[model samples]
Target: LQELPVFAALDLGTNNCRLLVAVPTRHGQFRVIDAFSRIVRLGEGLTASGRLGQAAMDRAVEALKICGDKLRARNIRKARLIATEACRTAANGVEFLDRVEREAGLKLEIIDRQTEARLAVSGCGSLVERDTQGVVLFDIGGGSSEIALIDLTGHRSPRLANHIVSWTSLPVGVVSLAERFGGRTVTREIFAAMVEDVAVRLHAFDGRDRLSHVLASPKFHLLGTSGTVTTLAGVHLDLERYDRRRVDGLWMDRDSVDRMVEKLVGWDFQQRVANPCIGADRADLVLAGCAILEAIRAVWPSERLRVADRGLREGILSELMADDGAWRSRGRQ
Candidate 1:
């Protein structure tokens, strides 16, 4: 165990740049040894510009350089770095990647939406209980939302992603929605508009009703893996500061989610900033995220929501360890 090699995963998304370094723990799991996250807003103005702006690229590059340093300092046995929605949509996304490789000393591949949804489900697998009938797993990002319907009826696999029955990645996200609808001073009407926008988009997905057989099961629930859901969990707990230990895997019933969203809608921009769970970094964007969440609920109503603080980085680490047969010996025991 002492000689276990380290693995790293970096996810550069539309709103944040993050990295996770970990070592294999039990089967299908790992302990994070080091991590970093910063809100670079890589998709800033992307809705209108249709290209990766110089400023957004510079901010992302700077953060990537720091991540590069962390990777260099450790003996990374395997590493997978990925760019998400922002890079996928931007016209000069490839050009920006070239700059990152040259200047930041990191190579990031833009992963498709299906891969993104799969990794998100894989990362949050541990939170799903063995008795769970099914789950509507969703990750609301800055530039997009990836949702998957996991039907765990007949066969169960250690890899949660294997049970995925259907999935879809919506182009709408907090950043894009906020940019179009105004984030800081959103009124009830504006918030509704945002929700309706995403709802309309979601209505068009064929996967929305694919898991109908298990949708009404008493044990079925919604599992959210995103900053938006985490923030909601944090606020619901009334934490003085953001605490992943308290928020991760926490359960929030339907009414609880409603109360938090309503409370957020009532608060002004500065009030949103005042909450420790949602500092200035997310004050403007939180409502936009809520809009996305609201749309998901309307599509697949679930009374309970299980919040997962983990996502792509953890998923990548799990795959890397599994690929190398890191857990085979332990599993045999």
Candidate 2:
């Protein structure tokens, strides 16, 4: 019997390190064979220091070592490992990646913001319904938030990313914003300040107005792919525990989103930590994410928002499989 060919994708973000290993399935989507995720807080002090700190680097390295082991264990036909926001902004970003290569035996490429936006759209492609005309997709990362304006008015492209008309990568993410505004002890005033700050940065984007027009149409809606939005969905569902099957592709209207954010704001740090979904790992940072989400909402004001649990990692897997013709090859076999 022929062994199934595997593909792997690793995403090292400011807040989390995630890996996905999969084999192409019949429906063009890949089936996960193995996966891993951990909050490494690689960008914990990056905003203040402008460099990757020793402690943070150590944490990230340890996570990467585990990912490397997973990759080596599989017969990976193609793999793409990437570092985002944290590595892109830190002064010693490349140096840290060098250490990662040496210590983890995995080469990680620091992709630019454009590629980051593209990959995010690609990852959440399936979430966009075929009838949808225009959509605004955003990924709130640890060190940055990427917002892409996708126009599907004319014809739907095979690659959802092809429909992206404009996109922006905000320097502020959950970690950076939290560090700036004090993630813990967030009052309504503090959260508002964070939202205002992000909104100010967003105002400079030339596409905001054009996207705003697209958003006015009922056919358009907001799509969010990030820990922040997923946590919101989980909290809204009041799930005893986090479940991707329930959270991913879940829809939350504007009022529902507002209620969840308000509920979170009312809770103190300990309460947030106590929540099953927003446990100790995300207790401090979840509000920072909410603030960014608020900023996006202020700009787009889409009535309905869809949650996506997948992003860059799925995008990388899809791209690698397509490039390798893995599905087609499987068909022949």
* Clashes per candidate, residues 3 or more apart or on different chains: 0, 0
Root-mean-square deviation of candidate 2: 1.5
List model 2 lDDT by residue over 105-178, tens digit each: 99999999999999999898889998888899999999999999999888776688989999999999999999
Report the poorest 10 consecutive residues by lDDT, candidate 2.
208-217
Cα lDDT of candidate 2 equals 0.92
Candidate 1: where is the Cα deviation over 4 Å? 330-333
Specify the highest-lDDT model's number: 1
TM-score quality measure for candidate 2: 0.97
User: After best superposition, candidate 2 residue 104: deviation in angstroms?
Assistant: 1.0
Q: For residues 300-320, could you state the per-residue lDDT of candidate 1 as single tens digits?
A: 998899999988998998888
- State each model's C-alpha RMSD to the native: 1.1, 1.5
